[model samples]
Target chain A: MRRELTISDQRIDEQALGKGRAMSAGMGAAVYFVGVVRATEEGRPIAALEYEAFQPMAEHQFHLLFDQAETRWPLESVRLVHRLGRVAAGETALWMEVVAPHREEAFAACQFIVSEMKRVVPIWKKAFPLA
Target chain B: MPVSVLVLFCSDQAVSGCYKSAVQVRVHFYSYFKDLAGLAEVTESVAPGSRLEDFLQKLFLRFPKLAAMKKSALVAVGIDYQAGDYVLAEGDEVSLFPPVQGG
Candidate 1:
């Protein structure tokens, strides 16, 4: 299966993740990363964070990141789901699943994808400070 | 000047004299800018061959507060980020986003 990348306003589905399990024989590790919306931002208490994305472009950028990761690591599959609209503090803002034959590459590629995703993804965040 | 009216007063010498026609760009704002602009999208006109920066200057003129984000804003036409010097074409769907803080 190919990389599954999505940008949506709904909450992330935790149960329907890591579908690449069937390929586990060839892939030894599945690294999952979850990015949460912090209770405070820049030292200020926050009620929640509002996330928005240029959908088409955000998806495009994530594809590029997937491509980048492929050349750098032998991966079985990649999955990324970023939330939109309002996300409460301590909630999942992002969820990523990276599958590879080795833990090193699985971890490295997972980190690389997130780093590159942050750099180029056309996703924006607005913090709502607690009054 | 209202951004809608400023379209007719383009400063780009490349097409300044030719006021007969102009390129219309559909602009969409995201995130911080979406709220700042108070509207999801708006179509703006600019001189033929006008660069993205030229159009942004006019946009800032209409919304002085947005000017503060001029340096940090990200511009994209279609699905790719575009440089300020990139020339805009007719009917282009332009998107402007403030510095992203996504994870």
Candidate 2:
């Protein structure tokens, strides 16, 4: 089992994620989400945003999240990535992929992962208002 | 000699504050507070029976920006967030997290 979770600002490698999905091809289906940086926040223009994380704890929590999903579902793979530092508009902010024995489980796990990540992770972001 | 509480900031500065001889607590900061305080952690001395809220009040007085964020900030002891009146013990790690809005 992989223990280190990828927490970064670099763009996600969809091909790699697809490969991971393919490894579990016969098992079921894969669900994925890519969060992109938007140009606006609350209807106001945003220039760029800064993301910071308490790395050690955040990584630990992420591993726990993955473990929980695996325990709750017949999942073959789970991949999650989040960006840190300053990100410009239209850039990717985060991505998550999960492969489960069925579409329903995959979909549910994907949603749960993203929502819980936002609610529990020690990562925070600050948006800069556009001038 | 009385046990002195040491508050260490990310800036590499350490401050000695009044603390009870029996308890040593570490406080950490995030987001704007980390930036403003120029430190990731602060150590403070507490009375033997100090409440978490009272310790926080002392912190707020020392760091005005931290005080300002109190309303919206979330405080956690180690991995769990505790209530204002939770009793602190020696070597407890307290974290101050600003509102999080990450995907």
Candidate 3:
């Protein structure tokens, strides 16, 4: 499977993420998720978010997630990218894509990856309020 | 009974030269714990035979903010995730991670 862990200080490349997976003749569905930094935090207005991660550990966790996903479904590829440092409101902070032979597996794997990433990965974010 | 004494006791064990086999483990902190500790990493001197719980007790005593996150934090040694009962080795790269909120 084609898996990735990208950490950038700049805005995530939306177009690049859309083209991350190679079109396979056997694959019938491609599901993608992009998580953007929103403007509110618990009803409080926010300017942006600062994200931090233990790089080595985070990468290792991604591999573990990929392994689990592949074991549960027949997948063609998986790509995950996360932004670090300061990300302004409305800016994309994360990207995830999955390709499979059917929409059922593709959608299931996509949801699983996103949910598990939030629950298990070693990345954290703190919101900065609008002044 | 105080946090300070617990911290000093742990340090004295290493400083008094009593535990000649003491080794240093570098702990990298992330997220709110980093902000609270005001450091990205700290060197923890632990006796050679100590377990992960022993080291964490000293660590929590040194940084109470981390102690508060005991239930929510995740830990790893080197590249693999480890349980609190796992024994620590010399020069281990231990890291403490707060509950992830990433998407």
Candidate 4:
């Protein structure tokens, strides 16, 4: 079966992330990344942060990264979620989960996926730090 | 023809200002740069054949905060980062991204 990629702005669900992991169980290993909004920015208190994206381009890039991962590694499934709109401090910003038949390939592909996402994804973050 | 450039900043915050013109190129800013400018996009006209670095220097003059991040920031032309001296061309899409923190 072909695994589809997930993209959303709502809060990330742990159960959903777990489901992605579970889907890879018999396959071998899973790699996951959870990006959280920190409480501080440049030593200032961050009250909230808003994430904006060039939606169509960002989604296209997300799928492209997943395709790259699948080709580069022996991954059975991959799921990536990035939130849009306002997010409070200490909240999740993005999550990437990749499952492969081997730990090395899973770890490496996960790292590559996150780095590439940050580099190419047309997503921007604005922080509203406490005064 | 004058280059058409678009500068984008945070619309809600007074981070900086916005400039829109009938230029051929587009410039994008993200993170603190957008926050300070209070816009998400700005457009300007640049003389043809201007170097990307020169355009950035002009931007720094307009927005001093941009100067601070110059060393670490990355500039992309049509989705890929270009060299310092990359020449501005008609209809080129440029983007400025701050240091990314993702885990």
Ranking by DockQ: 3, 1, 2, 4
Per-residue C-alpha lDDT of model 4 across residues A1-131, encoded as one tens digit per residue: 23555556688786767864555356777778788888998888899888877566567767778888778887888777788888889888888777788899989998998888877776777789776
Tens-place lDDT digits, model 1, residues A11-129: 88777775444455788888999999989999999999998788888898899889889999999889888999999999999999888998999999999989888788988888998
Question: Per-prediction DockQ, in order?
Answer: 0.59, 0.49, 0.64, 0.17
Candidate 1 yields a Cα-based lDDT of 0.84
Q: For each candidate in the order shown, give its overall lDDT on alpha carbons.
A: 0.84, 0.79, 0.84, 0.73
Q: Write the per-residue lDDT of candidate 2 for residues A1-131, one digit (tens) a residue.
A: 23225888776676776665454346668688989889998889999888898777788678878888888887787878888988888887887888777899989988988888877788988899998
Winner of 3 and 4 under lDDT: 3
Best by DockQ: 3
User: What does candidate 1's lDDT look like per residue over B1-103, in tens digits?
Assistant: 6556334545344775545567789999887787788888988888789898889899888767778888888888999988889999877988888876777
Q: Native-contact recovery for every candidate?
A: 0.72, 0.62, 0.82, 0.18
lDDT of 1 at A125: 84
Clashes by residue pair, model 2: B7-B43, B10-B39, B10-B40, B19-B45, B19-B46, B20-B46
TM-score of each: 0.83, 0.78, 0.87, 0.67
- Weakest 10 consecutive residues, lDDT, candidate 2 chain B? B7-16
Comparing 1 and 4 by DockQ, which wins?
A: 1
State the DockQ, from 0 to 1, for candidate 3.
0.64
What ranges in model 1 sit over 4 Å off? A18-20, B1-20
For every model in order, the TM-score on chain A comes to 0.93, 0.88, 0.95, 0.89
Clashes per prediction?
Answer: 0, 6, 0, 27
| Residues forming the 10-long window of minimal summed lDDT in candidate 3 chain B | B4-13
Model 2 has an lDDT value of 0.79
Each model's iRMS:
1.0, 1.6, 1.1, 3.4
